[model samples]
Target: MDPRESLIPPETLPDLLAPGLRLISVGLNPSPASVAAQVYFAHPRNRFWPMLNASGLIDETLSPSPDSMRRLFEAHRIGFTDLVKRSTPGVAQLRAADYRAGASALRMRLHGLAPRAIWFQGRTPWSQYLRYTSGEAPAAVWGLQSQTLDGVPVWVTPNPSPANAAFPLDVLTAQLASLANWLARRP
Candidate 1:
């Protein structure tokens, strides 16, 4: 049986790699805008770039251009991926089964990459990932901090998406700041 046929392999996904991708952000799926741009989290309203900037994770703001972010992500040794290779407009559009399946696949990739951490944004995805994984993995800040999952750290950060208005800009910045601090020590 071909395992590749059952799910979207990492190759088919819009993945980024640097000198050695130390951190890989695992998203539930690509946004429609991201798919169109072939960049992760490319939506104009998405707060991802701004959040990273405020957090100090990125020294400067990534221009709202998808192409630019790609270059930046690569330069930083940070990668982006989605549980589902396809795109959907909103989280509500996804189903429980999707999270379960995505979680299962993610564990496999987490092992393959051997990244220092697998950061998941949005609590929904994190909770779903935890549930499907059958137990706890390291929990990281906003999802931040150093913790281990099968020996690799797992960090959970606030979803920089506009949909998550609960985390105001300043608060989000603080959370990301913690993440930045952790990352700083890693290298």
Candidate 2:
């Protein structure tokens, strides 16, 4: 086993998913901090929660925690999942096999759940998903993509990880707001 495997907890993170979800946010994978906190984007510096709230996607602000995630699901019809289920200190620890397996599993979930739309938190998850599932790594631009995943509309946004400082919180919020607008326009 990889030395990093020893550092990861046996339970990484669970997918907050349900049938007929209006939108599902897909991250590259769970960070060690998120796994430890039992919440998605739990790192203190991560901008996901703040950006999500400022985006006007949901009326109330939500902190990174199990209850907040449940609120997003039960109240707003939003959900969360990751391309890879494993928790790693950094993406460098992930292997090609991990992406392949994750992409396969994600494909199955998307087909089964039939979420109205998918919001990929960063380019990596979508690129890896495509490469592993269809042998295609198309250039991914931010915002909604022409391609659909099993007929579900796909949207991309800059990662909210603190490490992705290039995209400030405002930009992330704007991207998410655009997604919310699109969701509203959908029948």
User: Can you list the residue pairs that collide in candidate 1?
Assistant: 140-143, 140-144, 141-144, 143-156
> What are the clashing pairs of model 2?
none
Worst 10 residues of 2 by lDDT: 6-15
lDDT of 2 by residue, 102-186 (tens): 9999998778687889999999999999999999999999998988987889999999999899999999999999999989988
Worst 10 residues of 1 by lDDT: 10-19
Name model 1 segments beyond 4 Å from true: 1-13, 17-19, 135-141, 145-147
Q: All models: lDDT?
A: 0.70, 0.92
* Candidate closest to the true structure, highest TM-score: 2
Candidate 1 local lDDT, 71-153, one digit each (tens) = 66766767777765556788888887787788787666666566666677766677777777866643434555344557767
- Each prediction's TM-score against the native? 0.80, 0.93
